[model samples]
Target: MTRRTLHAIRHVGFEDLGSFETPLRTAGYQIEYIDAAERDLGQLEPLAADLLVILGGPIGVYDHDSYPLVADELQLLRARLAADRPTLGICLGAQLMAAALGARVYPGPAKEIGWSTLDLAPSAKSQPLAALRDVAVLHWHGDTFDLPQGCTLLASTPLCRHQAFARGPNLLGLQFHPEVRGDRFEHWLLGHASELATSGLNPVTLRHDAKRYARTLEQAGTVMLNDWLAKLKH
Candidate 1:
């Protein structure tokens, strides 16, 4: 049997593979990363992988002018989805996926920059996301995506209606960061302190509850990852 290859695309230097890395390693998959911030997307192709995991970043999907690689990466994501390959997109990655699928990506009403609960849709109760119903996921996004046509809405929160969506059996777009862990959350808070303050969220409160949230967040990531990986056999 061949080992599954998982390509993890990183958008920023601080954002490393967190909890998701462990699970994929345990599942016996070969994991590789392409840093979109420093490297060219054309050089780091994702088409060869059995699974493609696009990690979250602080940039918006439409900021392609400032971050030119955003457009190229989104193009690669579109090709991967078109080929019916398994793809998992988180936060900004989700927005990119939505845009690639012809959906609009724009600023959300308010920035959801802390731990929030996601209300699972009826369709989410069946498969990959059933375990996340009514669960609190670690959210830190300022943008949201419109659900692409033919996609099933999986989850939502009071702030963002399109918290999660699925197109076909292979592609998933999650608005929250399920891969975040203890140190990663703290690091993110510190790295984006100015953005947090501008958005009217206190970094102090986020730091205070970081540990408690990390434990729950890890459990949630496990559930989601397990369910997602199970679909690979089909």
Candidate 2:
């Protein structure tokens, strides 16, 4: 089988594709990392890859004036999404996708950190997220977005209403960190130590939850990603 290109827009080093990497390779994708900070997104073709995944980050969507890379990503996403190419966005990535799709993205009422189970929409039971039924995923984002027009709401939590949304089979946006790996989870705690401390969230508690829930999310996340991949419209 021919290998397809998978371009992942990574904002930070540790926020790389974690559990999704192995499955993507097994499915014949040659992965390429486009570091949003280091790479010139202007030089990169928006729709060049078979798949584009926008990874999670600490940046907010409205911070484009401060972080010019946000503008580049929005421009890139608008082009790719206009063509309806296969795209996946996680956390801040999801917020970016929503902004690109003409939806409002802003800070939520409260920071949703730690592990929590999602309330999947009834329709989501038949969608790719079905594998995540009752599975607790890591929720590390503080920002939320409005449900984009013409997108189906997939999952939600009490804190955020638009936890996950999909536009047909080609586009998906997840507001949580289902892609986080258990072994490398320390990176998250240390990397966002300031944010955690500011929120009065102890790393010890998050570490304990990771031990309990990360493995389950890893398995369920793999299944969800593979299921979504199998159904992609080429």
Candidate 3:
């Protein structure tokens, strides 16, 4: 059997594949991380990989003027998504996907930065996100996007209505972080410590919640990713 290639566009070192890595490997995927800061996204062929995943980052989609790389990523995503190739986007990645699809990406009503379960849309039961029906996932972003035209809304929360969406069997976008690892929860807290402080959120509370829900989320997130990969239109 030939192994499939999975290219993950990573904006940061720590925000990586997490629980999704094991299932991808078990599914016979050869994973490669494209560090957005060091690599040239425009130079790479967007439709070359069997699967392309855009990981989360702190930057906003509207920051294209400030960060030229945002333009490169947008171009890459636009080309890949136009082909309807297997693609997944999380958080900032999701926002970028929406923008590429002609939707507006901007700040949400509030910054959702904690553990919470999604309110699955009726259409989600028949979708890959059904694995996260009642599972608590990590929410660490402040940006949100309008649902792209013709995409099915999967799951949402009170703070954000467009938490997740799917254009087809090959495309999925998640505003929350289902790929976050509980064991490495501290890295998140430490990485975004300043943001937490600005939001008046206490790390002690998040630490306690991570202890309570991280394991459960990890298990559920793995299930979700595996289920999605199985149903991918490859």
- Top candidate, metric TM-score: 2
lDDT of 3 by residue, 1-234 (tens): 569999999998889998889989999999999999999999989999999999999899999998899999999999999999999999998999999999999899889999989999999998878888778888999999999998999999998999999998899999999988879989988999899999999999999998898888888888888888888887
- Candidate 3: the clashing residue pairs are none
Give the best candidate by lDDT: 2
* Candidate 3 Cα deviation (angstroms), residue 160: 0.3
TM-score of each: 0.94, 0.99, 0.98
Q: Higher TM-score: candidate 1 or 2?
A: 2
Over the stretch 8-40, how does candidate 1's per-residue lDDT look in tens digits? 888876676688888888877899887786678
Q: Model 2 compared with the native: what TM-score?
A: 0.99
**For candidate 2, lDDT tens digit of each residue in 69-141?**
9999999999999999999999999999999999999889999999999999997988999999999999998
lDDT of 1: 0.82
TM-score of 3: 0.98
